[model samples]
Target: MQDEEQDRPLLGRTVGITAERKAAEIGAALPRRGAEVRDGAAMHTVPVPQDGELRTATESVLAAPVDRVVVVTGAGFRGWLEAAEHHGLADRLVEQLTGAELLARGAKARGAIRGAGLVESWTSPAEESAEVLERLLAEDLRGQRIAVQLHGEPMRAFRDALAEAGAEVLPVRVYRWTDPEDLSALDALIDEIIAGRIDALPLTSAPAAANLLGRAERTGRGEQLRGALREGVFLACVGPVTAAPIAAAELPYAMPDRARTGALVRLVADRFARD
Candidate 1:
């Protein structure tokens, strides 16, 4: 059975994975079906610099139980726990959140919350943060204290919206998705993509896709790269969020109906098999 499975269609194809947090796991999944994974880690996850900003937020949450807590991303949720652990307050923070109404932007955040032994009071449909805020606004939120786990990008609009609805919002920005500190290998990967050296690319986040294109654009090879993607190279994104930039660029790509890692991989495998 193992040998038969190893003889799968992707046996000699090269797949590029640009995920950061679970880069290894994504890469590992590709090989089981026989695809060689190229490490295209354009971004790295880093806890918000040891600056007191993150600590202060966690402290505030513990000081007074927030009326409602909104978790934006799984990565952000995990990052918060990690940062709190550094301050020896992970357990306390988790305990403190028990009394608050927890909301998740998507399944990812819900997963993180559950992993921490916390239950989410609700989750937004379509995994959109805006939907979560909109749903909360329909109800009475006057004087409600809400804590939001920010995921890298600035969501001033989200904060402002909550405030307009009469909710005091406290943003707990735990970590950011930043470009890799070292650019030594990025150029090579771009070159390979242009040269058609890679067969497929799996993007797990919008930022990673944007960063990859930004780097290519800086090198004056953006058009060529896009052409490559449109012509032969397969670009597979985890979901609509990750596919948004690719779509905006007018590039052709494939994505599964559900934004899950396994589905993304299967979509890629199916694409390769058809070709």
Candidate 2:
């Protein structure tokens, strides 16, 4: 029994996941590697209520030729195009986008652009929005119309920067993040983390990380959670973007070289094996 346990590094360990989209997928992977899984989706993702807002933005983008288009996430980019198709504007939108410079924030975004039969002018080397913004700011963008596809949340700073640079900004909000329908599971996971029962946590998105920390603060367990994290709770983030909130909290976390979910799972397994 001891020898077999040695072969499975994650055996007997518990890992908590807070992503709603692929919680089941990630949860299954952890158990296969011998770790117990706890699924507590911190937030839920819903398509932007098609209440004309998205259509209005689409129409605006098609109103004139855009100088640049920013793709922030693969799913969001795909969703935006689908929404456009529903409004009978997908083909036109794609044609307009093809004429402009496309900036992809990461590999997934790049893939989405290519899948749409469009090529990105450049992809951020760090897969960070900050890097994307930096690249745009370095250019002269006055009087340029730019469209930015938003993921689950608004990129206020990124949009503001472009607008300040004298460019007309059109934000395409494909989806929005909302609190989970059921808070019980998330609350229970919070309890487990505070009690140090969860050995590690694997976070896939920045919204999930922020939502987790926000929930802890709301429940008056923020300090306790921070203490537990500092004391030795392992945090495995998919990438730096997902680690931002945790990093701002001055907590330590490990990130995979690549930002894919599979890489994140492998990172967790490798860390436990090393320990």
Candidate 3:
């Protein structure tokens, strides 16, 4: 089977990748399947400096042990830890958090917490902030102090829910999302999709999907581009979070059973086979 599969099923097919951190790996996955890959890194992650919002949140958490702590993303947690380490407070921060009732949003967060030599009291099965809030609300959190490490964008709804339940929430944004320095490449990709020069586009995050559509709208090609995607261009997302904006736009898309990059590639390959 390995010998037969070497034929590169993606040959003559074109797919787009919108991830920055894992662009090389994801880009490589497509060509192996015989598909032409387009790099569509929509945004980059920028860590907040030591004297930024994260530092303030760190000071507050270290001042006193929080009643409950929520970790939203593994990468964000690692970034926070690195920042704390730089300030020579990594050990203290870890010690303080270990005393709190640690909660994780998903497997990734749980892994990060465990990697830091701490244990989580529980983790949200849904792997999202809304679900995390749900699990936390199930407890008697009135007047409890909760510290949240936001991955990138602020999860305002999750924070608001905690406040409504009378929990003192310290929401810390450890990083920010900035648009790609050059979107000319993205614009060119858009032109290819609209012109039927491309076959599929896989989006790993919601922001990239939203920004792609936003760009099309700004260039007055929204309808034309949307039409192409809905009709022929295969729009594949890693999972629901990435698919949410695409769904909201009423565009048709495909997602694998698991939200992994390998699964996404297999999904596209299988999709082409079925058609």
TM-scores, each model vs. reference: 0.78, 0.88, 0.85
Location of the lowest summed lDDT over 10 successive residues in candidate 2: 1-10
**What is the Å distance of residue 21 in model 2 from its true position?**
1.7
Q: Write the residue-wise lDDT of candidate 2 on 123-179 in tens digits.
A: 988787878999999999999999999988687778999999999999998888988
> C-alpha displacement of 217 in model 2, angstroms?
1.9
Residues 1-275 of candidate 1: C-alpha lDDT, one tens digit per residue: 55544456687788877777768778888898889877767777677875588999888888776899999888789989988888899989988889899999988899999999999999986676667878889889999889999876556777898999898889998877788766656677778888998999988888788888988898799999898889879899887667777998999888876666888888888876765
Off by over 4 Å in 3: 1-9, 106-108, 123-134
Q: For model 3, how does the per-residue alpha-carbon lDDT over 97-166 read when each residue is reduced to its tens digit?
A: 9889988978989999999999999987756666677788888889888998986657666788899999
- Clashing residue pairs, backbone N/CA/C < 3 A, model 3: 10-33, 10-34, 10-35, 11-34
Which lDDT values do the candidates have, in the order given? 0.83, 0.89, 0.83
RMSD per prediction, one decimal?
A: 4.0, 2.5, 2.9
Clashes of each: 0, 0, 4
